[model samples]
Target: MQMSQLVLKTLREAPSEAKARSHQYLLRAGYIRRLSSGIYSYLPLGLRVLAKVSNIVREELDSCGSQEILLPALHPVEIWERSGRIKKMADVLMKVEAKSGDFVLGPTHEEAVIEAVYQDLSSYSDLPATVYQIQTKFRDEPRSRYGLMRTREFIMADAYSFDSDQEGMRSSYSKVYDAYNKIFAKMEIPFEPVEADSGAIGGDVNHEFMSPAEIGEDYYAKCSSCGYRANIEAATRGSKDADAQGVGSELPELLYHYTPEAPGVEKAVEAISDLGVPTKAHEMLKCLVAIDGDQRLVMLLVPGDREARVPSGMRLLEDPEFERYPYLHKGFIGPMNAKENSIYVVADLSVKERSHFATGGNKAGYHVTGAVLGRDFQVDEYRSLVVVRDGDPCPRCGSALTLIRSVEIGHTFQLGLYYSSILENARFTGPDGQQYPYYMGCYGIGVTRLIAVIAEHFLDDRGLIWPVSVSPYQVVVVPLGAARSKEIEEVAETIYSGLLKDNVEALIDDRKLSPGVSLADCDLIGVPYQVVVGSKSLKEGQVEIKVRRDGTTTKMPIEEVPTRIRELLGRSL
Candidate 1:
């Protein structure tokens, strides 16, 4: 491609609102332009990068025997209703009213894909079919940020597999898992697949491929010793004995203390500290009031220093909800009186290790001390409901865990019969003349999001450093003073043509711009290699080759430039 004719305008300053480095560089480098919040238009360069990523995904999935098929982005609302996801995914579903009827812009194609393949594989002999598609998806994201990472509309490579039973489904899942490993390996990025919650997708088991990044919004826990890793939502910690230390042989009776100024755990601790009693945040029993979908109040008890993982279909009690239950104090909630107030109480597993705690007195601005678990409060059940933290013991090997911020690049779900059972005509006839719902699996890769993740993952102080596999152009040829120096221009054009003939993706800077401007733009765009066709270098019968990754320069004879470039890219000369 010739830079002089390319429709791109490099920016000197990124937009003020572009906080993430990838977002800033993609805009300043002219890769993408924002159309609206959470929507973008990929320019030529950006589109090329996306195409390269999509191709890698396609090649990997195809090699695993997954046939490619495109499903409709516009789905009938009735299908979603029948699948019972219309209410479950209502928050992100984009509804549309048309002349025919109501429709939904698909955030995912689980329902659509099931409907598409229901008839083709009716018999057991035709079972275990996998189909994939690279297409656009839409979601009504409440807050989209960091460029393509979280967009309302973007391209995705989604695949669905159908099998006769759980065993066949797991086999297909394993194949796709192997394919995803190869796909990310080809992209040249560091990633880990961790056990994750299926969320609204509704699967019993799933894994999320994560790439560590400072700007990532998701977090995962990794065990340092045993190499156990899991997404935060699904991560678990080692269990402790119910009769662990901190339990006293003779516990003191629960006593209420007047703390008129205490509104939170911190303030209550302060008020108690003023009374000459030393206490730590972890010594306090924190009770979280929440309401389920049925409007039943439930009390979640955990250590003050820990946070409760709110289960699905439940949310923390809000102000209006507090009004509904006049007996429940907003900030001063306790589990000691839960049974009396008709509130179900669930306690974290860690709470069993500690017997006595400083807890709320169930009244505004009041707290209680010496409250023993079995003496004063009774828990209906114990659960691993606390968010896993750094230094937490690994559930698998009892090793200390480390938390990392990462972006989810891909996800694979062993959906079983979740979608197939709900969709119409999704059963197959077995050898015994009985019909059963097909066990299913779904996999997805964010095609456009990868462009940003790769940019974010591999970069320096100057700009984005895209991997060679996904770079818009592998080599950029810059001829210093090309318009003024005919010799330099001829040499650059010759080198560019030679590289192209050798199947190397090359770009020539033919614009009449200053050397500094062109070279800076080259670095900003992050092409893997730069062939400098300068007069001084040509005088030595050699040209300068600059490696973008390490900023190393090498001089080779002009005649060997194309071969050298091919060799550097691991291609046949």
Candidate 2:
């Protein structure tokens, strides 16, 4: 490619709205332009890089027996309803009303792909098959920010695999995991695979590929000694001792106290101190209501010093169990006198361990002080109900956990008949001809997000230092004084043509620009190898060669430029 014919524009300042370094550099380098809050339009340079990413994905998917197929972005609501996801995925699913009245933009193609496969392939002979696509996905994020990190619309490479049984699913899942490792390796981005919650997907076991970055939105905990890593929501904090048995039953009698204007735990603690209530003698039981539907409310009790932790596996909002009630008060909710079979009370292990505690009196302007847990009240369950914090001991190892912000680039899941059961995607070849639902595994890679992660991990103050595997061009030839002198132009053209003949991707800057301007642009683009044909070097029968990654520059004879560049790129590639 020639700079004279290219519409390349480099910015002096980064965009103000871009919060991430990758986003800022991408916009400033004239690679992409924002169309909306989370939408962007790729320019020529950006498209080249994106195409390279897609090609790598295609090659890896092809190696894993996955046939590339394009699915419809517009899907019927009925298919989603059949899979029981229409209501379960209400928030993130992008729905549209058309002439027929209802539709949805495909955020994922699990339902669509399974439905098609079941309709066409139903025998044991066709039991194991994988299909994938590299396409655009639409997700309706309520708060779309941080550039492309959490986008409302983005490109994703999703692949779904069908197997006859659990054993087959395991094999397929492992195959995809290996392929994903290769894909990330080929892209030259450092990533870590960690256990993750399936979220709305409803699966048994899932793993996420995360790239470490300071500005990432997701927080995951990792053990420094051991390699145990997990998202904070799914992480475990080993165990702690409970002081339930030490305190005597008759230590304090439960008493109701008149207290007003103390709504929160902190304020209540201050009020109790003002009233001269010994802090060590009494515990605090914070009552909260976890309402499912309008008809059911599960009261949750936790220690005042600790907060309630919701399990990631239990997606009550995504489950059909709580579809009827979407609006629930968060801050002002409390456990009053139990209504007629309308509420279920549950207590945390920490709360159950306390002897004397302070709680609501089930009325306005009143509270209970010196309330013993077993004596004053009895609840249903005492389980792990506290959110794990930083410095908490790891469950696998006793090492303290360190929280690191990271971006999710890929995920693999053991679906375990979740979708197959709903869609009736089954096959039979047994002696009794018994039909059983097929097992499934799902894998996804965010192709565009990988680009952003790479830029985030591998860039300097000047611009992106693209890895050799995914760089748009391997070598850039800049001819100084090419517009004024014919010798420099001839030398640069000869060298560029020779590089192309050697199967090396090269770009020539033949624009009517000063040597300093061209060299600055070359560094900004961060092409790995630079061949400079200037009047000074050309007069000495030599050309300047520089490596962008580490500022290594040397003079090479004009005849040796092509061979030297080939040797350099061959070693790096």
Q: Which candidate is the best by TM-score?
A: 1
Candidate 1 lDDT, 1-573, residue by residue in tens: 999888799999998868899999999999999999999999989989988999999999999999999899999998899988899899999999999999999999988887888889999999789999999999999999998999999999999999998999999999999999999999987899999988888778899999999999999999978889999998877766555334466776677778888877889898888887777889998998888869888888889888778766577887776787777876677778788888988888898888789988888878888888877888888877789999888888888889999999999999998877777588999999999999999999998888889999878888878788899999999999735588888898999999999988999999998888999999999999999988888999989999998899999899988778878899411
TM-score of each: 0.91, 0.89
Residue 253, model 2: Cα distance from true site in angstroms: 3.3
**Number of backbone collisions per candidate, in order?**
0, 0
Q: After superposition, how far is residue 39 of candidate 1 from its true place, in Å?
A: 1.1
Question: What C-alpha lDDT values do all the predictions have?
Answer: 0.89, 0.77
**On a 0 to 1 TM-score scale, where does candidate 2 land against the true structure?**
0.89
Per-residue lDDT of candidate 2, residues 1-573 (tens digit): 897777778887877888788888888777788898889888877888889899999999899888898888989999998988988889899889998778899999888887666755566677788889998999999987666677888899999888888899899989889999999988888788888878788788889998888878887889989999987667666644555543474578666665687666776666666777745322677766555435356777777777667654331233353345433223223344433335566766556456667776665556667665555565666655666668877777778889888888999999988887777554445335667777888889988887788888878877788887877789999998636588888899999999999988889998888777788788777678899888898888999999888888999899998788878877876
Screening candidate 1 with a backbone cut-off below 3 angstroms (N, C-alpha, C), the clashing residue pairs are: none
Q: How many pairs in model 2 have backbone atoms within 3 A of each other, for residues 3 or more apart or on separate chains, i.e. clashes?
A: 0
Taking all chains together, the TM-score of candidate 1 against the true structure is 0.91
What is the Cα-based lDDT of residue 16 in candidate 1?
81
